[model samples]
Target: MTLSRAESAADHDRTVVVGAGLAGLAAALKLAEAGKAVTLLESRRQLGGRASSFLDPSTQELVDNCQHVSMGCCTNLADFCDRVGISDQIEIHRILYFLDEQGHVSRMSAAPLPAPLHLAPSFLFLRFLRLGQKIQVARGMIALLARSADTPGESFLAWLRAKGQQDDTIERFWGLVLTSALNESIDRIDLHYARQVFVEGFLARGRAFRVEIPRTPLSEFYGPVLEASLRSRGVDLRTQTNVARVVFENARVAGVSLRTGETISAKNVILAVAPHHVASLIPEENRRQDDRFEGIERLESSPITSVHLWYDRPVMTYPHLVVVGRQVQWLFRRPAGNEGYVQAVISASRDLSARGAEEVLSIVRAETEELLPLARSATLKHHRVVTERRATFSVLPGVDRDRPSSDSSTAGLVLAGDYVQTGWPATMEGAVRGGYIAAGSVLGLSPAQSLVPSLQAEPTVRLLAWLAEYIFPTRKGTLG
Candidate 1:
């Protein structure tokens, strides 16, 4: 049954946001800024949900479960940082260095060219490919650019294969990009999302250049920053509270039932929770009664594991690097004072999750020694393992069909999550995009005009003309 008119207007003009993750906090901030009475509820005492951080008792320092990085195209997330006043707490890099299984290092940096052309040099110098392989990779990228953006295309792996990419090329280069960007293999990722990642990450000139990571823990980076900002704007943030169920009187949502049996009435309710939690909150009658959530069942999830090791000596020269041909996909060096801390992220991980913490740590140590020789002789002070079984929705074949719209069927009830059909993978970009879209829905505004500035580069044709000289590299092209 849906909610009655009386209940709908019980708290007219007020909006309640469930889930205190990025999506929920983003919606609350947006709605509150629009002069709407907003209340945010989080089940956990602390915010940031999966992005939350914990303090290490031994070191008395803060640490995040995983190391997350964002690129220049992630305008929504950057805007979020701006909104929360923590933009300065994030550091951005212009160059990305890759370390292959063979211990060969290649640096991908931006060129002087406009948007997409700026990436040509980095592509040419990539050590993972041979001279012929580099040409094939460029040709494949051009073909991808030529494809229609609106229609769903072939699997990324198939498209590469059709472009004559060898198995070795895919394993050495394409696999690393796909696995890190989508948290799934190339063969399994949806073409639409993969294309988006490439377009925003590589094709855009200055966009692909700026890679940002939080200098602090997720909570400090977002939780308190958002909470203070929202509260200052008069948003009500309820923590450690569970919404028993949403009350529907007629065909609309009336209010939410709290664990205390108290009902908080609100005209608009944004179900900013994950997809798996939606079925539990919505009324049984209103639900489709399917085993899996509709419009999202096609998406499956893969796991990611992060192993943290504290050492007496610094083990890495750079803050982060992508590892190829190893169990360790990415390694981040987080140094606090004299203590050296490192986090190794295993993306598209399955078997690693089943292993014990000690086993995971040992593998991470071995892998670290291979990449950074300094780490081999360092004394291990401490180790911790964090695993997110459903770290992100698998970007498998036909996954686009299962993506859900930001707007919900029920009035005043919207869905928000990285998995909610954002045309991006379940990365920070997707989560922030979903939040921005959902916030627009809550404020009855067009998503295109949200607070986040658009990062869409000019049409490829126009950009190409302006960047012709830089696009075609000569033998004399300077690496520096």
Candidate 2:
């Protein structure tokens, strides 16, 4: 039976959203909030997509596919949680802990100062770097802040070298943040995005540097809580529903065809899935003719590895730790109510991904013990290693130009995903922004009207950022 024949004429006005990830959820929520009929479709039985969790067959406990984190600069993601009534489920941490291989922990918290300077106080105390090294790092940051425009097709590593940043400074400071945030090597990341990360996350405001982490399992957090909330808002939520292809009429989207030989017709369709999945949905002839589909093939993905370990006793005292100069980039004490269970994540783990699971576990366990001495006394009760080979799209140099906008050449078809040009990296915030922009396009609303504003910058901070650009305005074009 056709979904169109099963509904009233009001169904014709419904906007069908494919994929139930953050992007799709955001788009559906915005459309529903606008009093527009929304039907959300997900091929998976559960929601949240990559930011999801599943039952461990051996332990029968919930484990996330990855460790998802948010920062103070992620206003759109915070807004989405607020709108969905899960704001309280997120725990805000003012202090960030960084642990060295020798188990020396350095605490980083903002001081009661203005933007850019707020973090300066704590940065001075980091035990990982020497005083001379910190001064050099500070100079590199000033250069990063002062630059006005991006050098097209330039890697951040090249830009960093041009600023006279030493190799030690790049690895100890710049690589520490960009590798985890962008999920790509510093050498491959675009300079434009690396600058955005620092300016918005650290230099914009004092509060923008704070961290936000969920206190519950992703499956429960997104499954019941978000599902109920979206459904309550009159959204037709369907899981385990797959769309075979988008049916177009005269180069316009009329509806989507299901794998089950059924069709759901709609006037507005938002393709919120990954870039690779997108081309298969649109007809070959249309994709060949559309500029929106161009260059999508050039977009590549990065990998992330998460290692879950359950010790016989509590080994980690801190809630989380940023492991400096180690293959295990970030470690989190699992919030799944399992005592002694913790997860270690390695982003941009291409080298590690090629290793066997046992080898990966061994490396992670050794690193954890080295960083946290208490782990040496604890017994490994159980363990699991999960590697998402295609975790996020690589924000490579010149890749932003290939990122299409929300509007498509095919009428009534909108695009939404972290891969879109959301002016942010492949993060939850970017996904939410993409969804809002796509929904905004459908409603004919401006980006300002549809999306939440970024954290306000201090007056002096704005002036400094502006002055830097004004002084170095000729830093455009290709940088060798």
Candidate 3:
């Protein structure tokens, strides 16, 4: 039963992955690992897509388009970073704080305790919520965690009303959490999606508090790391390569035609690009039966805006702050050494985008100064505005059904993107998960079973540790 070299080489499968974002890179890596010849095509000169960063021409310093943060449950993304050899570049914060425009501050420490109990003190002390509101919020959390069945994929606002939560509480606390987690307003977000956010980020024991933030620009973090990793694994990464149309024959993908009039056949082709671009690349006939592919048309998008400022002096001491009752949702103090650079992330920014750059910058500056009074005395160095008009699919009511599945009807074609249905919102985690799922589907592997091993172990360990701390509360004078 001796096989010849030609016979052995002929057994290898070839896969083409379009787009070089997190989802695309993840699929490409998995395929390569499975002994498939993979080629990744990216229209942009650099990778990371929306998460990319650039060097400021004036200061010659690296700056990301916006700041991104991840929690402990972001195992898939962390694993991808580890595989790419840059996991250490991310810093994890066990404790997070919120600062309002009036200089009021509330801190949430990752102190070990029972599931929701660990967060109770922080919730009670939150200046944004009144005493009665805190109790209502606690009851809401209890109800959410105790529920056995999934909520209907309807408006989160309606769900809150059904839970007996008042509108004032939703406006103060629930709305902020929903907006930050889903990147959509509470009135529009699906209840199930909102529940998933709370369950995964807060209720899942230690999973809630392990906040990981990028130390370098995302483009530098992901672009080079992924490019080098893929190339080393023998993947043909074609930058500036545009796929004109996906050619299909007899309900199967025949090949892809390039913009320059070239063609390459593949055993499988994964369409890992954004939702809006899917219709143009796929054929009309193939898209007809493929509900997942066609579902992209039903999904709407939300916008995210960022205001970057370089100051003559450091304006804030903290690395990040969550602001309530303000246009700015989150703020980050970038690593500029002696120089001062700050970035403000405006999530679910609708009205902010309608204003001109000067107006937007002015509002952000005024808010920043109001929150950080010391910034008023500091000299303004430079400012820049970055807006992602379609940053993510709107996670509004009934929109969840529109999210595309990883599997498509076309035999040789799969889909991957944050907007694709990964049982999560349009986030880095969602994007990475979609890539993993798409890769598994193309390679004929059970994604759920493959993911189970990693998912189960850590959560169990964290849960036990949390339980131990709860049963035996530490005394103030106790020493090691």
Candidate 4:
């Protein structure tokens, strides 16, 4: 039963997008908003991908993959949230609380000072880092500030050492920030992304470091709410539809084949799935010649462990706390919801990934009770540990050259994921950026056309940026 020429032409007019994760959804929404016919296919009924949430059958409670926080610097994520009308569901915190190994508390808030010195008052008063360590950190920042751009292939640790950063600064200060932001250790992260985290997230503006947390579970927002919103925009959102392989005709992407043996042809296709998944789905011939697609094999992944605990009573006063010298890197208080639920995040969890759930919970529970004063009084109820082995693609040294562009060599195909060359770490911001880039490529628009403008740089930070620019006049990479 051959389809008529008109029918085949109609099928070719459609645009099919694989993987309804953040990157895919963002691309779909943008295309739909632009009046393009779009179809999004997802393997799971739910959305959000790596930053997704799931329901526990026993307790019937919803849980997120981990605590996904958006810093004020994440402009694209904020823009996407605005588009989806979920921006209000996120709470932006101006102050960040941290506890040292000895359980000493410190608060990080912007001071009255402007720009580069805005956090000076708060940072100077931090009780954890010694005075000398602070001086050394400041000096390192100066070195980082004076330096020009760094190659994504260069090692972050090597750069830090060359900048005269001490072990204490790396441990107490740099380590804490890098591990959380990069989702990889300082030694494993690339210098370009690490410095971007500092230059954009920290030194750009006072509020750049402000943390944004969702008021409710991620499933509650990205699930029905987002699906309905996308549907309203005329997107053909298909859930529980797994794409088995990409169909090629005449050396171009003809469409995609589903596991159900159904094939949907399209004029344009965006492969938004993970890097590892792409090679399997792509045609063998395409894999053989395209070095970009072949390089997906070389990219490594890092894991994140999230421990959700139900306590008898409220355990923490702060919404979230950054922990130093502990296996649990970050603890987020979930608004005392449903019997005081708490989430602990361990980024780049190499050492702990091999441990069993019960064992990890036992060790983390004991440590949590000891660290927070309020936790000592609250009795532990139930705990569930969620571990994502390939939570994010590690932005390792010398890996940037291997990252594929949004527009691949394969005709009628584009790519979108946190792994794409989004010029950022594998955060929600990067995913959104990837989608925007892919959408732009599909629409034949400029790279900057679809991107949201970055938050404005303050006057104080502008001066420091000016000084840094003076050192390396060609280095004018600012926020956004």
Candidate 5:
């Protein structure tokens, strides 16, 4: 599409955004809405980066890299979808199902009660955990609610043990939640992020725990809708465009150099690409001098594996299930129109990477049969394994210190990615928050000023949180 009159007027004042992931799309959308001349560059033909979908040759169906879900607390992501006019395509499910090895299913749904207690009734009746274990888990939740800050270099695993949680309680309750939410093991997850997930997602608001899943494939959800929105705002959206490096001239940002030996000149540039790509984009001398650049390189990524299975008939009765005490962490039924397809997700799947596809399938198939009785009789039509080696940055203890903010030392250069310090874990919400922060840096706004507000806590919930903090003030020391 041709540029609008307003875009033409501000063509000289260009802000170039690299990477077309959620971060880049959010940044570009904000700048375009602000009437800034924007150019969004995406290396791949698809728009949603890791969140995008692909066409499987074997099944000839659009498949998401992994099943991505958003909670009600993910306000920025919800806002982005609404802004892009794709909000109707996402369906919110309030009931969450958890299945154990013995095929017993436990449903967790919100009641009419207030925050922190709305889901307590269902949680207390979970069939997977014994009464004693449930009580122990409840104590852990209270401790998490009362905590003020995270201990540096401490993992959630250590925190749970210190809270008097045992193997059964930790694995069935804590692991089930943290593994799926953070996409990392409890031993490696930062306590701050773990607290954020529970406090915001579970304890803060009754609606916060409701999960939202896209009704369509991710590509259809983000690619076309986002591209149309950007283009309508007169953003120059370029796909299959590889950026060679950010051209820094005289200690300031110039623009980006394309791999085709072409350079796009701009005063402001946001390197919203992956962390590893940042070092090569800058000059060698700048990399040596900049501490943030060095820290970005030190950040490590965790893996997620999605196993797609198709059967002759429906194998799962529920839309999704949180599989406990197994390598398979979550199982999801494909959205409507695809009845027989089910996707199993294994977060922190480094061990599975070493296995062959058939072996992996065998193990997953066995687990599926055990969890869902219908799967045992259904015929396996097709199967595919998709493993994202660098799915998300590991939220390890003390790792947030290494996460770079939107502002770079170099003038006119900004950063945006899930790996950036967004206060949340590596999620769609965190990504959009980083993008907004980057745009704010370019538009002379504070991070808080640019981002959308989180879902508000009820008055009673807020008072309880305050009391917890006020009564038991946190001290600077590691827990046993």
Candidate 6:
């Protein structure tokens, strides 16, 4: 097609994607790549939404709301990074370091064993779990494997107790992993989605647990890069442009009205904001009638707390470490030097908000000193406490049924977000999946058309996957 004809074709497929979060960014990019004239709108001046950064006045550096990471299971997010030319800013960690309160360390990586057994070596050698506790944990895994993979009906806590999981095992092992992944306590997280994290991210693929840590501030990684790419590809991105309402005519989306009362006409629209923001944006006439839109209102939020600590000297040896037996869940070391900067993560940290920032920081500092000897003597240069009261949606039992699909009742309107029934938790992967699904919805394509293929198991791991199914017959459902 000629340049004019191509431009005309793009005009014919003009699409408006609201909220330049990961979902909106990915959807806009996918549509633009697919020959659509795409316009991305965000109410905020900066993009990346929850995964964004702010200029810290005290340190004069960009600060992320919290440290975010992608896993090998996040195929779509990886693809999005590669497409946006920012993949080099990400550093992948094939190993993880865990530290108990006593400062006992355990190095965890994929062992040479087959699929489900790849993590067996590290778990077996860990000093944290006694022999009896290990045995109990093994039994718990057996019980988890025996349970139904689909049709989640209860809390993961209930399932763990029924499996005879000890309180210590639950706290040190299952709770640590589950709380971090789901951003909610075991009592609130669904058994089905929790199982999906272990089975797909741990069992189905040996390397799926690898972490992708960003080397730069999230602000640099997302906003500037996306702006450049969108402009080059003729995609319009409007910052600080609040979409007031989804204008509909005859049960079809006519356009979107801005806060300034100007209406931008478009052939298609994708609602790509957080779940809480959905109800207000949709016309009252349509939301009350469609259960799918109303279901988003039923979803709730979970809080996360991150502590950024700057020390005058090196405190931690590893890039990151999981803290055992503490409210502080994980620690991430900023690159270049291990000494100067580090972050502490606490998922489902509503309780932390009740305590003042100084108290929280004091406790975190004490805990840090106990774990890393260097921290005791190191001069504390600076510290910042970041608490996102509603960092993500609480994945309560049966929330799977509550999420709406990308295609909506209004003919040209679609939905996209980490909360939009992506089968994955509210992570980078899920957001990217939602974006791809939304892009597909507007372009008359299936998810498979825009989404990267799911990562496959190694040859030996594939055999172990079959063995896993045979031993535990309940492994018969889709992995998100």
TM-scores of all predicted structures: 0.90, 0.96, 0.90, 0.95, 0.96, 0.92
RMSD of 4: 3.0
Best by lDDT: 2
lDDT of each structure? Answer: 0.75, 0.87, 0.77, 0.83, 0.86, 0.82
Pairs of residues clashing in candidate 5? none
Which ten residues in a row are the worst by lDDT in model 2? 471-480
> What are the runs in model 6 whose C-alpha is more than 4 Å off?
1-12, 142-147, 458-480
Question: Per-residue alpha-carbon lDDT of model 1 for 265-309, expressed as tens digits?
Answer: 777788878766777898777666332357665568898898888
Taking the tens digit of each residue's C-alpha lDDT, what string does model 3 give over 1-480? Answer: 111224223233667899988899888888887778888899988888777887889888777878888887777888888887888888887777888656888888755666546766666677877799988887666555433314546677876786678988898789987787778887888767876777667766655556788877888778676688889988889999998887776778756778988776766789889889999998787788787765689889998999998879988888788888888888888754734777888988899998899999999999888887778999879988998889989988777678877876778888898987677788888888888889999878766833412333234434543453443332322211
331, model 5: CA deviation in Å? 0.8
21-138, model 4: which lDDT tens digit per residue?
Answer: 8999999999999988889999998888887788887678888878789899999999899998888888888998988888888999988777668888889989889999998888
* lDDT by residue (tens digit), candidate 5, 82-107: 89899999988999998987888899
Q: Residue 12 of model 1: what lDDT?
A: 73
In candidate 4, the residue pairs with backbone N, CA or C atoms under 3 Å apart (3 or more residues apart, or in different chains) clash, namely 153-398
Q: Give the least accurate 10-residue stretch of model 4, judged by summed lDDT.
A: 471-480
The alpha-carbon lDDT assigned to residue 15 of candidate 5 equals 90
Candidate 6 residue 193 Cα shift, in angstroms, is 1.2
Using TM-score as the measure, name the better of candidate 2 and candidate 3. 2
User: What TM-score does candidate 1 reach?
Assistant: 0.90
Residue runs of model 1 more than 4 Å from their true location after superposition = 1-10, 289-292, 335-339, 451-453, 458-480
Task: State each candidate's clash count.
Answer: 8, 0, 0, 1, 0, 1
